[model samples]
Target: MKQTALKRWFNSGGPGVWLSAGAVSIAVIMTIGLLAVIAVRGLGHFWPSDVIAAQYDVPGQESHVLVGELVQSEQVPRARLKGAGLPVPDQGPEFMTRDLFKIGNRDISPGDFSWVIGEWLKDQRKPAQLMTLERREWGNFYGYLVNVKEDGNVIAQGEAAWPQLQARIERVQGISDQLDRLEKGEIGAINHGIERLRLRARKLELDGKLDAAAQADMASERAEFDARYKAVESQLAALHADFNRDSLTARDGNGKEIEIGIGKVVHAYQPNAMGTMTKLGFYFQKLWEFLSDDPREANTEGGIFPAIFGTVMMTLIMAVIVTPFGVLAAVYLREYARQGVMTRLIRIAVNNLAGVPAIVYGVFGLGFFVYVLGGSLDRLFFPEALPAPTFGTPGLLWASLTLALLAVPVVIVATEEGLARIPLTLREGSLALGATKAETLWKIVLPMASPAMMTGLILAVARAAGEVAPLMLVGVVKMAPSLPLDGNYPYLHLDQKIMHLGFHIYDVGFQSPNVEAARPLVYATALLLVLVIALLNLSAVTIRNRLRDKYKAFED
Candidate 1:
């Protein structure tokens, strides 16, 4: 009876159903686990970690004191350390534990990180007096505040120097912000205007239309821009002077004293002295900075706002370009054109295109879009910018177009499927109501297929957002001097190269010189990318659900 019941269950497909459910559940759990790991590793990086002052005693070497944040710990075989040419003491079984420390002060130390054996560390203490300096360059500095100086003279010493240094840093930061605004906003505008004038003069010269009046107008505009530039430059000079007026003297664990300009310091805080509330506030502040600020220090130490902006802009552009073409093609094939062997062959071709490697599309885009089409555009309309290659270069527009081409087949297939699923009676009924085929398709058929179109778009966006290989070939760069969209005329400059999160991850993970420092940033960027893709997909899914609900009666 038990064997008969088991056989019946198997024959009823219960076992298969259970296996499928199990597989799906495992996949969901793994995805959630992966995201959790990434979040923990990435988000934890922003929290201020206490610095440990400890003495290290290795065999056959003089004892020395070390100060820095303990980043990680691990256990490894003692033979591994010996193989790596490190003197491993005979203790702690065949494997020994080790701690990795981020001993900042890259300016003084030979390296930023150090790994010490567990048996070597002694007298470890979290000293509240130890200050951590987040610098604009050279990673970070961990030391003791000695004094504060202004204009080459000591203004405050000992504990009093801390508050004085904070005040001076605030003043310097204010000046720095002003300087940034002047440089990137007003000064940038003036410089752009001056370039436009120069280009206009060149265009006139090429056309043999440089009359005296035109020359006078051009000269006047140039002079006005030059005057504005000088004024901004003078203001910038004064700001720099004030910004550099203050400095700080600090001593490291090795008692090596160094003087750092206050302008170079981004923040100075004693983590060991910070209360839980203070640490929480600092954590959120750092997280915000990571999200909003431009990257600095070889793309390792700062935020990724530009990358995020570029990614969303490129994906939106791709969607705009792909939708119409894909929809029209699908409409003609499935609605208007008679189905036959030719139609089947075309569908086969499109399915095959979807399977084509993305990098192949990138190569084609470079050759066709940037070189052939963009070069022709430059020669015809922008002759003055020739040789400099405005559109005839890898940029945001080309990247968008490339990704659009890569995603079009998916959209076409989806729209066709949606169209095929709609009842023929609906179209006939609309036509029977004295409606033309065009009107019937637009009003009755396409509306029913809108949900599918959104589904296709969601898929396209998910694929495009994480694509790195193709973009690197077509448009992505290590660093973009300015964003593609800005306050300049033609506000969206599509011909500018852009940074992308995918490439940023690849660069930081594999290409960075300081791998340990860049590791957490890689996780952070990956997490952000996942979140962006989720948000984008959620938006499309919402629209799709609404459309499906509105048209559910027709499907039924």
Candidate 2:
């Protein structure tokens, strides 16, 4: 009875009539729930960028809690002292920074970047036995520093002897004092004069019953002087601050280990060298400074504008390139070409091309464009720009071209479908009125198919904007110091390196020297890329939908 009733209920019509619907619904619900959790946690990690000051053990002089003697590298040179046949030394172990690599299980791989610096952290009045991240701990970190090309080379096994921090600080302070004298003499006087002038001007401006022309002239002069004064004052203030060292700060926390924030922060450690990866080690404070600061160092430090600019520019170039070729191919196939085996073959080829791996396109682009064309052009036209390479190195133009190839199929398919959907009578009517084939195509078929063309373009833009692999093979730089297009003599230097957010993501996550510092930024850049792609799609979709609606009544 129960079985029959259950079967009947399962077989019932409407909502009751179901097979695998419950399973599907449950699966979907679970999928959505999981995604929601990941998004919430992942996204939250990228926000609230604050940089707090932290100090390590005063350089050189360190306390050892393990025993009365200072803990040195010889104390426990390797994590597994017995296995290495190197027992923890009886004398205070003098440690090396790279030695951290031998310490088992403390891999910063998933976390990304290295934040080890050899310094002192004053935790309370007592010199807390803080593990210095860089100098002292670097020896331990060397094992991990071993990369694909070099093993045991990047890291030194033994402790490196260097002048103590106390000595270095004294020398630095001596120079700093001399610099301070110059500031006090020249800078202080200049600032004082400007302040006096400002006060005088304010008083004069407020003086009543002056002639209109005199008033106008005075106001203009005062404004100009004020602007110049402010600019100089700002620079002076910055100079003053740079010379001053920050005092130690203390705070009471809820004993809560703060959740590390992930977001974009831009700084350049290396000024010269193309494709040099400047992975500035992460600091909690660095993150906050980046968010609130404007770009400097030729728009390098404290700003991610260059990376953001490259991403936008590359996407635009890709879209412009792909849209025309894609739509044209689509138009020819749908409107001009006759339906036959040849057309079918072409369509099949296009569909197949779309499925080809994006990375493969990168390889093809590098060979054909960078090596073949770039080399040929360099020889013929730009012989002067020879060894440096005008178009040889993988850069912006190649990246854009690579992306365009990837997007072409999308545009072609969308446009072809749109063209097919147009009413036959529209074309026939135009032809019947003695309009030429070209005229009919331009005035009738194209207008009707535009929505589809727009749709294709939008899709292409979204896909190309966040592409990384093809860009890797092409012209995306890890750190493009100067953008491709700048206010230089030529204005548009096509051969120059360009940055991309997608590449930025890879660099911050994998290539940064300061992985701990860059983690939050990696997440932020990913989120930004997603938002940007969505925005591109949204804008394109809005236009396409509007065009579709406008033509809907004609179709009806």
Candidate 3:
């Protein structure tokens, strides 16, 4: 091929040469331009210098300014803090618990403080009060550690906030209730087992000469039984102290009862995670954290961890489910089966399946897996668990299986091409050396085709991660309280509901009641997913290219 190509190159001074050269040059230029544009836009998300910080205040009155020091305080002036009698700070640092500031707490939502510093400077009103100083920062006013409460020299404090009298009262009641239950013999004491064991030991001691090992075993059992009984007793005491009666009852200031109705406290608040963040500064420090964090009723500790987990799990499961079946099928077709009418028909069918719309698979999965198969299992195995679900519920397993079916054709096609690419001489030589057909197929063919198989897997992952409609039919919940796997009894709970990044982006952008606020997150999530898929493809392509290079010398 090299000699022929060299000969042709020397002979060719015609339109074909010029056309190919022009095409290559054009492609190179276009690719460079595209990369430059994407780099400018995508990397721009991380540059910190261009942050447009703003805060909100009264329209007419001049807002207070912080000229030299940026004050960070939860306390607004008593006059400005109250809104319609509620203690809502108008423009100040939000009150946050230590836990709320972490990367994990999705329950916390970001608040709005939109007034401009320039407004505070021009306005005759007092400056933005300095509350808390992070450290002794003298350069740029990063944030403030101390608020206007200048009276106390010791500003930073984390003292014990003693429990109120009512809380103590509740703890006493909780303990009393347990004591009453014990008195009434509503629950048997764990020590009854110890008493029985002691009586048994006494009887056995009189009648038998036990061996040393037997005596040690008996002692060990006694120790274990005693430990368990003590553990239960300790748990009862701890629960009484930890959750007072008030802990059971939810309430807010003013003694207003707080009841999270069936849907009332469905946490889906995505504040800063949403909204158009034109302020480029917001992106550099907190942008990625905000997007990948677990969801909140509002986007306070914005981390899209759940969404990332869901997307990765679904795609991985889809790959696991699809790869073997598709690759095996291709292997059999290429290695074992001879050319026949059936083979041609199967090929056509596989192609047709590949061409089928993704939504149809979603519907099929919903009907067959969720409705028929799941419904049947629910009735048979989990009749007692009716109304609630077991395997009969639409969830993670079904979603992955559905996507696997959808991805099978891609894997099959890639594997088939790979199988075809292997030279027939390699197979014949192996067989001639007395290697069995199965051995040749497995040892010689599959390893050679691995790179191509990986390419198929990459494409499959990309498709599966972006899928929304099919997952919607199955177990993709908008807000899964727990992940697919957890510290629960059954760690890998396939039946559990899962949050997906693809569907999450859709829900935030389109389905959210607060679409205006949620739109920015949609872009951010979309961008992250794109980056992930591209990385996956890139890795696969690198492997495929290396494989191709290695195999090049072996070909005819």
Candidate 4:
């Protein structure tokens, strides 16, 4: 009876159902685990970690104080330590524990990090006065604050200097904001205007229209631009003078004093003194900076706003380009075209195109879209910018178009399937009610299929947003501090190169000179990229759900 029952269950496909469920459950668990690991590694980076001030007592070597955050620790083979010429005892256990410390002061040391055997670290303590100075250059400074100076005169020293330094930093920050506005905003616009005038003059000269009157007009424009630039330059000089007025002296672990200009420091914090609430606030602040500020330290520090902006802008442009064309092709295939061998072949080709390698599309876009199409457009339209090649370059437009082409086949297949699902009786009824074939499609067929179109779009966006390979060949760069869209006359500059989150991850993870420092950033960027894709997909899914609800009556 038991054997018969087991055979009956197998015949009912119960085992296959259970196996499929188990597979799905395992996938979900693995995905969650991966995300959790990424979050812990990346998000923990912003949390202010207690700086360890410890004595390093190596056998037969003088002891020295080591100061910095305890970055990580691991047990390694003693043989590995011996290979590195470290004084590991030959009689000790085969595996020895090692700690990696971020002893920032890269200007003083060859590197900002050091590896020390765990056993050699003596008198490990977290001093409340230990300071961590986040700097714009040379990574970070781990030391003790000595004094605050103004105009080479000591303004505040001892315990009084910390508060004074904090106040001065706040004041400098306000001044810095003003300076940034003048530099990147007003001065940037002035420079852009000057370039445009120069380009205009060049265009006239190329067209054989640079007569005396034209020259005079161009010269007048150039003079006005120069006058504006000079005025801004004066303002910038004043700001710079104020920016460098204050400096702070700090003492390192060896009690050596070094003076750093206040302008160079981004932030100063004593992690050991910070309460949990204080650390939480500081963490959120750093997280905000990571999202909003421009990257520094070879793309290992600061925010990834440019990358986030580029990824969203490119995905949006790709969606706009792919949608109508994809829908049209699907309409033609499922509604208008004759059901013949040629039509079948066309469908087959499109389905196969969907499976083509993404990098292949990148190559095609570079060769056809950029070199051929863009070059032709540049020559025909921007003749004066010939040698420079305005559109005949790898940029945002080419990247978007490449992604659009790569994604269009998915849209076509999805939309065609949606159309095929629509009952023929609805189309016949629409026609019987005096609607033409085009009208029937436009009002009846397309409306009901809008949900499926959105389904395809969600998939396309999910794929395109995370794509790094094709973007690298087309437009994405390691650093594009200046965004593509700015306050210029043509606000949206599609021809400019852009920074993308996906490419940022690959660059920081693989190509960075500071491997250990950039490691956490890789995880953080990967997590952000996943969130961005999810957000994009969620938006499309919301729209799809709305459309499905709105047209539910027709489907029933």
Q: TM-score for every candidate vs. truth?
A: 0.98, 0.56, 0.57, 0.98
Model 1: per-residue Cα lDDT at residue 102 = 97
Error of 2 at 263 (Å): 23
TM-score, model 4 to reference: 0.98
| lDDT of candidate 3 over 375-403, digit per residue (tens) | 89877755545666677778889999999
**N/CA/C clash count, model 3:** 39
Model 1 accuracy (lDDT, Cα) = 0.92
Specify the highest-lDDT model's number: 4
Name the TM-score of candidate 2. 0.56
How much lDDT does each candidate structure score? 0.92, 0.57, 0.59, 0.93
Better of 1 and 3 by lDDT: 1
Off by more than 4 A, model 3: 1-288, 298-301, 379-384, 542-553
Q: 1 or 3: which has the higher TM-score?
A: 1
- Show the lowest summed lDDT stretch of 10 residues, model 3: 131-140
lDDT of 2 at 140: 13
Report lDDT (Cα) of residue 426, candidate 2.
86
Ranking by lDDT: 4, 1, 3, 2
Q: In order, what is each prediction's RMSD in angstroms?
A: 1.2, 17.2, 14.4, 1.1
